[model samples]
Target: MKIEVSLLAGQQLKASFADHEIISDQSISAGGNAEHPEPFDYFLSSMPMCAAFYMRKFCQQRDIETTGLSFTQEVITLDESNPYKKKVSMKVTLPTDFPKKYEKAILAAANTCTVKKVIQATPEFEVELVK
Candidate 1:
């Protein structure tokens, strides 16, 4: 998959991938228009969203009800010495009346996020100016 990122004046940037377009901006204090989500916001959201997709699939396959299901994600920087990502955690909340038997399976399913796996693998990236 290929993505294109373009500057749109000031500190705003637009990223286009396939049929989707995501706008990234900085806060006024950060010298941006604050018109859209910051780049870090997208990065943080990717994990939970990917997990949620698998969670939904798990429920659908098992004929489980998806009402009142939600998740919370938290990021913690363990060591400032290690720049970039330090730690990411997610908590999946099931409905009060959710079946107890599926708890383990649900947790397992949510942990199957492809994004999380990729981050764990720590893929290498190469950056170069486009000619």
Candidate 2:
């Protein structure tokens, strides 16, 4: 649940969490080597991925087949005055044969994603320089 991030060469950043490491970097045009996903990419991906996890869990508990389950996320920018994402759309595709009874439950499960709740709540942050 804890992550430590440090600057690497150029615009690369390394983040370590739960005994694993992940890298983030800008594109070559953005002064980075583009070796890994950029910070914003990770931010945008967090919601859908979290929801997907819950969706899978919901299917598993119901003994439902998940062979064709898919989730795609898209972001829309509101205006030039705001450079951040204004809206996020997540599309979930279930197998045609999937049970109709579980459809609403599945959607509810996806809404349980913690990251989505955090984003909606707009948590506050405290930043300070430490030595």
Candidate 3:
């Protein structure tokens, strides 16, 4: 899918893709109104959201109750200025009634998230000046 990104006023930006639009802006301190989350925030969140959806779908397909299922994601960086050194940690919180036998299966399901796989594959990117 091709996504078109355009600059708006000041530090605000808009991304338009098939049937959807997302707006992003810098923090107020960074000279934007902070109308929405920054672009990096969306990128950072996409992985965990994708993983959680996979976990939930796995539980649902197996008729497992997801009432208490939850997850937390943490990002660690050895140096704040170094994005390449970042490490992401994701934790799965199982419900009280979750079966012990399916523990590994559930983890495997979450690990199958497409977003995580894409990052691991290190897809190449290209940019062009469109006059």
Candidate 4:
């Protein structure tokens, strides 16, 4: 996928890919209006969001009821010196009447998130300036 990103007013940024346009901004204290989610916030959410998407797909495929299904995630930094070193603790909450047989299957389904897979694979980045 090719995503084009460009700077917007203040601390805001815009990313365009295909037919989608995503906006990111800094916090109020960071000279931005705080009108949109910060870019890093999106990064922090990608994992759990991706997992939730997969979980929903799993449930939908089985015609399961997702009326009360939910998920939560907490991002914990391992060290203040290096923010990159961190852990993501995720919780899956199923309805009280949910089928007990799918307990482990639901977790396995969530684990199928592409973002988590990519993170586990540890992708490398290459940055260069264009003339």
Candidate 5:
């Protein structure tokens, strides 16, 4: 999967991934001129979505019935000196009727989620300037 982001102006960017598109703007407190989701929100979203995706697949395979699911994340930036470094904590909520017996199974599945694994492993990236 590939995503592309183009700068529009003044802390606003247009992002596209396949059929989806979004505009990301930095927070006013962060010196952005527009009101839109910031990059941090998008990073937070990826973790939960990854877990949800795998949870659905796991439930299907185990014949589990899920009426609803939701997740909340708390990201703590430990060092103001390094804004990019942070810790993410997630709380996953399943339906009330979800079987208790499968709790471990579901958790195991969540652990296997691609984004979760990536976060845990702390993947490396290479940055370069292209003209």
Candidate 6:
């Protein structure tokens, strides 16, 4: 999958992936960012969303009925020297009727979220500053 982002103007950006489009601006506290979600938020959001995606699929495959699902993700930076590096914790909430027998399996499915796997596996990328 490929995503493309283009700068629209000052503090404004646009991103496209497949059939979807996203617009973002700087934050009011940080500056003027339109009504769009910040990049950092997306990073944090990806984890829970990914986990939820896999969880839903896993449940469906197992004939489990998921009445509801939600998640909260928090990131803690252990070292200020490396601000980009941090650890994330996710709290997942599911419907009360979710089967107790499937708890372990569901948790395992959450662990397989694409974003979780990416963070844990630490894939490498090459960075180049272009003029």
Q: Candidate 1, residues 1-131: lDDT per residue as tens digits?
A: 99989999999999999999998999989999888989999999999998989988998998888898988899999889886647776899998888899999999999898889998898999999878
- Tens digits of per-residue lDDT for model 3, 7-90: 999899999999999999999999999989999899989988998899999998999999998878988897878866998999
User: For each candidate, C-alpha RMSD in Å?
Assistant: 1.5, 1.1, 1.4, 0.9, 2.4, 2.2
Off by over 4 Å in 1: 80-85
TM-score of each: 0.91, 0.94, 0.93, 0.96, 0.80, 0.83
Q: For every model in order, what is the number of clashing pairs?
A: 0, 0, 0, 0, 0, 2
- Residue-level lDDT of model 4, residues 91-129, one tens digit each, is 999989989999999999999999999989999999999
lDDT of 5: 0.83
Which one is best on TM-score? 4
Error of 5 at 87 (Å): 2.8
lDDT accuracy of residue 122 in candidate 1: 84
Ranked candidates, highest lDDT first: 4, 2, 3, 1, 5, 6
Alpha carbon deviation, residue 77, candidate 5 (Å)? 3.3
lDDT of each: 0.90, 0.93, 0.92, 0.93, 0.83, 0.82
Stretches off by above 4 angstroms in model 5 are 79-85
- Who is ahead in lDDT, 2 or 4? 4
Candidate 3 accuracy as TM-score:
0.93
The TM-score that candidate 1 achieves is 0.91
Using lDDT as the yardstick, the better of models 2 and 5 is 2
User: lDDT per residue, candidate 6, 84-109, as tens digits?
Assistant: 77878787787888888888888898
Error of 5 at 71 (Å): 2.2
Off by over 4 Å in 4: none
lDDT of 2 by residue, 9-96 (tens): 9999999998799899999999999899999999889999999999999999989999999999988887879776387889999999
